[model samples]
Target: MFTSGTRQLLAKSNKLCLKSGSYLKTFSAKFTTCDLYALVEPTEPKVVTENSPGPNSLKIQAEISNFQDIRPMIFSTGIPFSSSFISSLPFCENSFSQISSIPLGYNHHAILDVCSSPEMVLSLANRPSLTLLPPTNWADKLQNIHMKVAPKGLTNVFNTVDGSSANDLAFKAAFIAYKEMRGLPDELSEQELSTSMDNASPGSPDLSILSFRNGFHGRTMSTLSATRTKPIHKVGIPAFKWPAVDFPQLRYPLEKFEKENAAEEKRCLDQVEHIIKTSKTPIAGLIVEPIPSEGGDLHASNQFFQKLRKITKDNGVVMIVDEVQTGVGATGKFWAHEYWELDTPPEIVTFSKKMQAAGFYHQAQLRPKIPMRQFNTWMGDPSRTLIAGAIISEIESQSLVEKTKATGDYLMSHLKPISIRYNKLVQNVRGKGTLVAFDCPTPEYRDMFVSLMRSEGVLIYACGNRSVRFRPALIFSKSHVNVFLPRFESVLNKMYKQLWS
Candidate 1:
């Protein structure tokens, strides 16, 4: 897969390349990648067969192929994906997103209570076109639910169906804001109007959102242009000629390489400034993931992000922080970028995943001045908003964010020593809260370790090319960590001994 030089270069990973970037095109979502958290829990992984996707699972997959694409999870069974109950099979599920977007785990009590409510039943039964038909309490839903955990400084919200749609909504808001800031009229000129009708601009204006190398935003045409993580998601689709710059590949044990990492951040910032200044398609916005999870759980310092805020402010580019993966309490903070302490918050913050509701929150001005400019049929389901509200209530009352911080510290502390003990097998063990990940010596070893752990009854996942990522639910505790760690260590020991030889 690589020249010796290429292998050695990735081993160091000094600068993350954008196009043709080094990404793991993991064959199965169940087997590879990040964020798409697989939430298996409470019980240990159960494995009845020597090989996963054993005969029974393969037969189930074959049935799926009659109507759907089953190549990705060719051996998946619905049982492992259920958040309601532990898999009857030998492996504890990673609690990953299958058909399940379980908040607290599979069928969390709080979530179940909400879903069982008579009010919830009514809401579900009478689903309306939120944009066309009216929900009298819709504004109330946004205020009481989303605003409760709303990213700092954002006041307006536009809801969508999923993370990808959330991002597309954010991109549109940013582009519209960019044009408004340019003092363009809502009513276009004859040329602008006519050209836009034909999908050209001054109407469809040549504007771009600057993304980083290995940043995965979404699968939509426009947002996909801002996505630079892996080619498979974007292949055969015509991408907007948007500019993407390097995402910093800062060294791990960040405190250990302060000077070096700081220099890397500076280099990336310089590239960002250069692209914003020179790209022929005027840069309308800049989108960033707090951790770049799908790419490899890669992280940059708070200082790096703060500097990005300042730069976008100076350049008049709308700064959109894509928190679809890192939002909620997963990163110890309700919003991961909260650690950045930027004097100004990102102009727009998009969220999904754990929120269970999908949308972007923005400052008042980013709201389109014109009607019908930013809209969809069902603006977002109120039922999902109710679920999000319940999730919020649970997280706040439980103090899950603070608890996750403490638990994550405990987890990371334990992992560091293991990373050192099995130094050849793993390295760069890094995390914030329970959102932790570590790199294996190679992709083969990484996959083997993940599979081995599941066999031993501890389900986890792989991300990027060489990192194993942990994205358990907010309920995961030090107690759960205690249960998982010994199992993880056992698998690591066995894998190191057997595979290293």
Candidate 2:
């Protein structure tokens, strides 16, 4: 039941700017928030009516449906969203990770200040197609930001629109490098040129990317071929016959299943070897997520990842760590794969999400002999990168990575007991930093629990099938967690009565 007042506020919320002030001292003030960087105008959620996505949202859903598939409308929407939380009626702290974006949280003054800048507005007005004609400030911006935060070994960057495009371009780079390794001729033959037009053999080589089972790369043709999460995302679309191997499904409280998990990982590794040797189309690249998120926040031991690095190195296959979800301080470390401690770095690392900019990082060797083999009109957006630079500055100045790790330890310690008390409801409580997740007894239970948590004023999300994931922004603090945990317990208490009282 949105009032005319609430509706007007929601419509213009994006333009609501606030002057920066000292951090509010609330909830014990465990860790402090900077005056310039903290979230503002925080409010608690209010569920004014029964049923999530009440009449106002439903009416909006119908209106949007007249234009296109209204799937986004079907969601129990959090209408007025902010950096830390969203409010339909009940304002709840965000934990969806914004699908793992929103690095600083909704409207941090630093970012808003950047967004309101004359320079940022100019770029937004006349965006450049980066690959063809880069802005003069492009090199400076990359120097100050992207390169400043380049993954350990990778030197080059290719900015794109989103995680999917970042990965798609990364795959293209992999195939090009694969072709180079095979010593393919640069000049096209008459037959090769003609065959390409027909989408046949020599023209478009039968190169494939070897991915892991339950891994999700993207939804585009090449990536969707690698994606193996849900059948629905792939049911109607035709996919390439790319080969996939199993991602190790390790049992939790990892120490308990050490031997069995090692054996499981070894079995998976052996399959990778066999698949590479026997696949009909030669595998040009092997792409894997450090944590197979969306496939249910599945995790493997660091040793398992190291072994994977070894296997890809032994084979000619290019190793691509799809850091789209796990990068930028979410996983405690700056990069989740940093935990792997492999002898050699992966050839490519694709990133987006919290970084605000989307692209892959790779060594000089992966650069193609020629350009245009992988490009688009808007190679990337400069305005987004400007936001990214501010995020990087905040990350560095605030040391948010270290803060995230400490906060995660505190959270998991508290959550462990809840997992024990509510064993049937919350099991396998696992995480690295705040990229935490747990499983419900069933998908229906997970959905119900999420709605209940919202009523208690803590916004969370579900992934894989029965798992609920916590992806709070880097700015998430001890205060936020303290606020969150009690609400979580209250929901658990209410749920216990409803389900088992």
Candidate 3:
């Protein structure tokens, strides 16, 4: 099934793998390697076509574009056929795992086992409306799967569709809780009942969720209103006139700029407090991402987050930590907010991505006393919940969280030196665990950097403005890192020569 050129590439790759055979054997046993990895034991990425988005990829994209937008798609991914011509098809050696959603990497045995189970099959075939007709073992699944890693101080779970809907539910719960906190009657007044239908005040009310600028919660109507990253996600859509506060832009080599970074954080916190106290629309909820994943992978000190928790608590606002992108061991801790070491946890913790299932954990007080307040046809997918169970089990059994922390330290140790060497091209190296990123000289440079990484078969992604973020799966080991770094430096070297040499 291989052409002469492909055979030659494979032959060269085989020669390169001899020295790393011991490491490859051990690593492959720990996790299910992808098809591409199975073909080549080392970290080499192969592109058989003359240029990427090969004819097959382009043809598939053209067919897909007939019915949907293909602008965001990078390439078509599928199992290569046994045909001789299939050698031209490309495969990603190490993906960020579908935007960092894949926890254990592709075709993980645990996940596959769960998916192939009778429970998963039954759930998929006979889906449940969990709020109304939940499965008999639903509570067991929740306790085992979701609650197993529930953030500290949160006792209740509200399963929803995804990060957006999770935040949406959290918003509604906050609004309801806000009214309750005000000692309003449980029953809606006749005026409120009538006004809600027309989408006006008193029922729909002049309430809002305050979000930090550049923090992304989700793309649903209410969550999108709070999303302040890119204009494209918000333009042409009507949004709530909600309040936003500045997120601190801390400088790198943190110790070098402690005073300035602290001052910047204080300024942002002061703004947050001011908006909370003085906004015309009562802020019922305040949503934030621990790492601000899509917002350039921005981070604040633990003290900054601890202060945020205290501020929201003092102001009686429901603090929702959007862990959609940073949760499930990506950031060393299962929940990134755990790094904050808060005396009291945030009121609502929203999560998705790696968890397979999506939802928010909250204090019981945040639960609407009335039923159907957060209802949906499929409250949450049971099959996905099953997958989440498998993921949680694997994370615990493998000690992936602790390992990820070590791996992150390893990555940073290499990255910091690289950043200094290529200071002109790479800047602001910051991350928690495997969730790492660095800024390029410009947005154009960042885009080119991503494209270059793709050409090398290391599929990465860009975030913020000029930032290149790495959201590798939890299973990303030191072996993978060893493979990734040489290529990473190669890309940097190429970019450096282009711009600076």
Candidate 4:
């Protein structure tokens, strides 16, 4: 049934092509193109050695750790093992292994095809400073891809280098808009501009971006001031005296505790309004994650977000939804906030990770009257945008968003019972699509669970104090979930027995 030509391509590509049963079957009936590309079956995890960071991986980590923190280092392996590991994992296939930033999968054929294109090569080789000299195709690229997918009610885009830059830019836009709303002129007087250099009020302006307790924006000066997850990140740095509001800590199995959760949300919303109304330094904006990811995979209801939106709008506070870790089809929707069904979209929605390009989408009003005020030498990279364009195209072509929604439901259904069975170690099993998480009884137990999982050849991570979060790629399939569930169940059973014993 093998066509000599098809066989040649497969051999040359070193990719597998499965034929349907029976050499006697007609060639066309037995060997379709879909059979060649579709995930045929889940592969078993191959742990060649007892230890996760096998001898070769340990050596590589040691060499790299000398020059870098490597404190968060996971063992490194050869491309073959890396690729194999990905194929067997839930979030990304090992073929194109990377940090969780991978959108589709490792060595995704679509991405590789884009990479091999001449235009992509040219963009890569001749990287443009997008703000100063945007490529001729920049407008088309934005209109066709990024703009096409903009959150409802947002019509403008301010491209940046990454998630932190997106947040920083959004904060700047909010600050400017806040000032303008308060009757500040577009052009600051020479005297006011001069006084700004001295960091005095009326020029530098006494305003802040209110953030929730334990929320993370980024590590840049302004962003760092708003981040409050850990002291280790802020130990020696001088942070702004910005107001911090309490993010609701709701009891989980969210349905069972609805009344309590509502009260908690109301309490948090009240605090947000109070901060805006009474802060010594006026609150120009409020930034929050749809679901607090790095902070702890914390989630609030749609009602909570809707209320926050209303409060911010009424108080003239710019509402910024940081979807850096939650955007681009992972949460069953392109943007997680889409689930909120906001009366009007948040004033700004910042994105990065899965989209590959970082930027904030906003209403046209957020655009500054002056041009150079909100810019940099390289506002964004065209090569990255091209890649992002290709990614968005693939998502549309393959219907990966709907696929992710279905696959995520399968995975969560599998996790729910595990949470019930191992009630002590696993609690609050909840998520939007594959953006799921549960809590361990304690930090030590959480760390141990993660370690055991890695030892078993599954890479995972913990967030907040005692929560484990899953951030798989959009292309992750139900078969991948099947591969991970048993391994996860085994680990949970082992942990439960050990804790009980």
Candidate 5:
């Protein structure tokens, strides 16, 4: 039930387009707001250019290459607009390409309304140094927004710049807490104070965070050490000697291979416990993604995660579940770790991506005793936090999390049959909620699949060696799934015919 003011606010921005073919038709309607996106989004994707880059995109790439690296640039979108499609020309995208960062779809009316508010203006204009001078409502905002969805058993939030910084700070907090647990004096000793400036141990200790193989945290100095997805991300970068453990590699269909998958998970869990017990450098914290997004969208059973949590607890290693990609509502549960149902929750859970704000939630114990250790300039942007608040509100009001679960189930029902039909091309279909993925026969095929999907105007992307990951926004509904499946099968059919030829 929208209030009069809320109705007025939505009505002001309700004059959106219903794109048909290449033409966008204007319609003015009073929406119930339950399915606000269908009114705002294009009916279907439209690709004007024969090639993905086309002429306009290539020209922009050439211009950008003069001062920036455009090697990573696939194509340029046209005029920015609301809905998943950022542009009105060249093509419209059902975006998952930006690494699942677009939370409530692009330029959603709710977000737009937030942007136009006095609160947003003040946040942008002031941009205060939060550590020294946080807004008066700072505490209230955090409690109302972040705490509203804080993972069960976690009560504190530490805001940072992005996922990488969030993990980095979490690591620091773990280290500080680790030393404090050893009954070290709160105040630094003379030797500890002097050695710190020289970047030596005792102060700048050789402590490390344990991360899994193919797990990616971030690219910051400390986080780069913990990331293990690709050598390309770590090559030539100096890294700490952090121990890397094997994440469970389960076979799919998970039901058919239950016994073997159980054995594999047990093997990995054994290795994790072994490493934590015997690492030469003290493993102060262990970080893991509930689903390793960049690492082929891998998954382990709830039992496996529970055992892993128990291992971390028994071994006295701080458990930091890195939910940078899997957090928010994408994974059915608002926090994916909720699936584990750990007897004692993980000490720290870091987040970014869809949440729109970057930070970690932890038990109060992880807060460093000494001040200025985990400090940063602009500790976090209030504007982004405000946006995050709006995102949460929209997610709650529309029951997007539950909807995502239903959509994911809908998507899987289609993908599983397609995988069987194209067994040579598609394998290992797996996902939770809308964060789904499938593996191609090879890296080349996966890349080709992504390229063709983009040409078909669905901007999907790949991960790991040969997996195509689908990262749809929370508003992705059954109608969107219907649009996606035919295009998906068309590409598969085309690829399969070509393979035989």
Candidate 6:
């Protein structure tokens, strides 16, 4: 139970603290205990110069560009404070800030505390190949980290290295489960084993995981097959002939377009069924994001997901909810799929990012019969798991999930008018928590708008070519929004004025 007065005081204190270099030292002195919600307040965005990367970033970039492809390189910041310059405007000062991927902000106290613990240090120094010889406390760490926030009815976890690998592993589980149901024996026969060497049937059977156009899973071989966000990520890389169905493209101002959006969802549902029934390859599973993140922060109603779950159950196809970008309290709920309230849990729910660990949660039945079938040398690092445990503890102790919901509502309420006022430049402002986004008129315009926002000292990210997605930390408070909104409005006004001028 966080009081508004406390929140305001903390925000004000943090603002003041950030302005001074002694904030960290003061914070360390004041709060010796590591409590989760102990620091849910706004911190000042450090701008040493007019630009983010300042002079230090350019030198680092110039040095790195000589050998490697530095196209994705943003400016770099030193330790304690991570920074990235907006690459498009190299000379622009105040252009570098943390991007949306930052969960608790750079060098979060809780995270650093966990890293400094003896248990964490040991795990990092003596990294084990978890698949073969996991640490003694691995099971306990899993219970504390992933299992603590496990979605309803999911008790088992298959840990992997990252989001893409998590989804890829889920796909493999689905394929194995489907084959087992088809009377395939646990042990491969001599013929099957020999044929598998040549990538033939019985081993490499004609199976596929159905995904949605514009949905992004990952860039790995199997996950890439399921990703359809952009051709640039797939070009020159071999991809599977996996089927992609249309995700519902709902009309904006949801209240005004409710009837049309319902019809659109129904149409997409029919298309999904059609693909499952008619594909040349058997559909072993269907992977969908609770919100199609990379596909432009696209959303479907709870009813839409419930109906999809029923459809998958009826067809004996595994239902996988890829929560890589939406999970771990970003979307109000710990798991975004919780919003759906389906009769049963998704067969697999994949997560990464904020969790600081990647894996799929499923029922006991989904576990492969043989151990080595679904394994890797370092399935997931224990130090990361330890950090994840700390994160979960902090989230619960501080009740950040509910806090995020409240703050997100606050943001959206303020953002709606901005969207309406600039309807031509900005449209379709929608999201479940702080995980919100809106579309700009064009890709170039969206990029420009993002750049301007960076220049104004607010960090944001782009998704689906024309949308600006907000992925702020759960600890973000209303005061943070107050600081952000004025800057955002100024940027919007500048854009509008520039366009007309």
Model 6 has how many clashing residue pairs? 8
Clash pairs (backbone) in predicted model 3: none
Work out the TM-score per prediction. 0.88, 0.89, 0.90, 0.90, 0.91, 0.88
lDDT of 6 by residue, 197-278 (tens): 8999876789999999989999999999999999998999988999999999998878989999999999999999999999
Reference-based lDDT, residue 448, model 2: 89
lDDT (Cα) of model 6: 0.79
Find the candidate with the highest TM-score and give its number.
Answer: 5
* Per-residue lDDT of model 4, residues 1-501, tens digit only: 346676555433433221222211332244443343333223556566688667877887888888997755566544543233224442323212253477976545566557667898898898887878888888998899789889999999989998899999999999889866566666777777888999986788889999998798988988999888988988899888999998998898788899999999899999998888999999999999988877888889898999899989888889999988889998899899999999888889999888888999999988888778798888878777777888898899999989989988998898888888788888888899788888998999999998888766677788899998887788777887887888888898888788887
Error of 2 at 232 (Å): 0.3
Better of 4 and 5 by TM-score: 5
Candidate closer to the true structure by lDDT (higher is better), 1 or 5: 5
What Cα-based lDDT does every candidate model obtain?
0.79, 0.81, 0.83, 0.80, 0.83, 0.79
Q: Give the local distance difference test score of model 5.
A: 0.83
Q: Candidate 4, 43: how far from true, in Å?
A: 1.5
TM-score, candidate number 6: 0.88
The residue ranges of model 2 lying beyond 4 angstroms of the native Cα positions read 1-39, 74-93, 182-190
* Segments of candidate 5 deviating more than 4 angstroms: 1-40, 79-92, 95-97, 181-187
Model 3: per-residue Cα lDDT at residue 377: 90
Worst 10 residues of 5 by lDDT: 19-28
Which parts of model 4 have CA positions greater than 4 angstroms off?
Answer: 1-42, 77-99
lDDT of 2 at 215: 96
